[model samples]
Target: MWFSVAIRVGLAVLVNQKRYQEWTHDKLKRFLENGIMPNLYYAIDFTLDEAVLDVILIQGVVQCPKTMELYTGPTYIPNNVREMTLPGSPSGRARPIMLITTVMRYHLPSDLDWFHQPLTHYDYRKQRATSLAVAHPS
Candidate 1:
């Protein structure tokens, strides 16, 4: 018998909006099931973050937590988007949180500490943080 633990990929979005953005879980579920990519926010050379979300969405299938196919572990996308209804609006947006728990070897991050930081009201501050590290684990 082949004994092995299974791994799976999970995607969860946590949004922080300037104003309350409206979107039901069903809507998001549908989009996710269909691999619909949101207008996520990220600066240049931040493909690591974007890639994690993209791969999970593109795969559009949950992988087991121990599945070898998934080298990257589960990714958790914490609330990041701000101010914008699902239908329209959005000067900017946040990255969709995803988990790749299938492959522990990869360790695809789900909840980076920065995810806890609130969005800045100031344009300059927000701009600077766009590419810089906002949180560090102690």
Candidate 2:
């Protein structure tokens, strides 16, 4: 039973992905009239742990314009990022915005390092600037 349910859910995702890929601008017009179809990005409710899935879903993902394939994490977005089909997706902004939520992000280090050292405002700025310069040069 569980296997059947999994297969069905997987099939639904496959179908939805396909529909999104093949949808044309004219398809949306049917919604205005007496359309007999549903071709929108419906919220998915998969059989997964809510907490873990919540962590994953909170980050915006990119979809290929032609394929409608989903790619999670901005790590995949490169200089040659494929254009997205969905308007206002902001795949470009996903990197900087979602960066804070990434696994690499550090939060309140317990050990007191140079950053935690007592210093004047000028010293702090100088340190920060030096660090930034070293991290990314002009």
Candidate 3:
């Protein structure tokens, strides 16, 4: 049997006049209307033996331990989008948090019986992190 774990990509956006939720909503609307996926890139480039299958969006409430403030917003999955609505923060101090989780198909050797590995243990982590700023700092 093969097993794979979903990878979560966290987006921390500061709230402004234009909320991040609007961007997500518009992006999803465009995908629904035209059936075109936006150009996607990993924060770091990587090659994978496994494949991502789908995505699910979630709006969850995260309560602060001290203030008990709640933060909630829509999240995303890979190829598919499902959403759950949760109430916003009472203090209205919770920033909208969007998390993208990639559903994946794993290819594990049948003889191995069990497998244990960290996502960062992969070869991609060894690759140097590069950016356009670094290329032309001037």
Candidate 4:
């Protein structure tokens, strides 16, 4: 079976905004000192193995005790627009929460046994509905 896990990254906006501004200002200042406007944006790539993924998943999400539902929402991509939510604390205080999420696609092979059988029909709609129900419980 193929499964997709969503990973969400959280960041504090208001508190970090000043730091970001200062960093940007410093970068711009350096550019000005060099007598040139910086052509912004740089790309970097890194690879991870299964062990790394497992560690991250374990650290990031809170597992549901009864259902064992793994909720790993978005993960931040260095420079990308992300969704923000207001999370309420135990004290009923709300704070801004920024999240960038991505779905991790993987597969689980089934054993060739009587208990494990493939679906007779490939009904994507039915599968999607089931997945949605599982993801969002009433």
Give the clash count for each candidate.
Answer: 28, 0, 3, 9
Q: Residue 67, candidate 2: how far off, in angstroms? A: 1.8
For residues 20-137, what per-residue lDDT tens digits would candidate 2 score against the true structure?
3465434522211221111112212112111111111223454555556765632323222324433242322332111111223233332322235454332122222433334566
Off by over 4 Å in 1: 1-21, 36-53, 57-72, 76-138
Cα TM-score of candidate 2:
0.19
Lowest-scoring 10 consecutive residues by lDDT in candidate 3? 1-10
Clashing pairs in 4: 6-72, 7-73, 7-74, 7-75, 8-73, 8-74, 8-75, 9-74, 74-101
A best-first ranking of the candidates according to their TM-score comes to 1, 2, 3, 4
Error of 3 at 15 (Å): 6.8
Cα-lDDT of candidate 1 = 0.29
Q: What lDDT is obtained when candidate 3 is compared to the true structure?
A: 0.28
Report the lDDT tens digits of candidate 1 across residue range 1-138: 000111113223212222213655565444344332222333211233332333332121122222223212233322232121221122343333232222123332333333444565433325435465568789
Instruction: Tell me, by TM-score, which candidate is best.
Output: 1
Task: Give residue 32's lDDT in candidate 2 (0 to 100).
Answer: 16
The whole-model lDDT of each prediction reads 0.29, 0.29, 0.28, 0.25
Scanning candidate 2 in windows of ten residues, the lowest lDDT window is 31-40
lDDT tens digits, residue span 62-131, model 3: 3334344443434332232222223443233232223222233234333321223222323223444565
Question: How far in Å is the alpha carbon of 55 misplaced in model 3?
Answer: 19
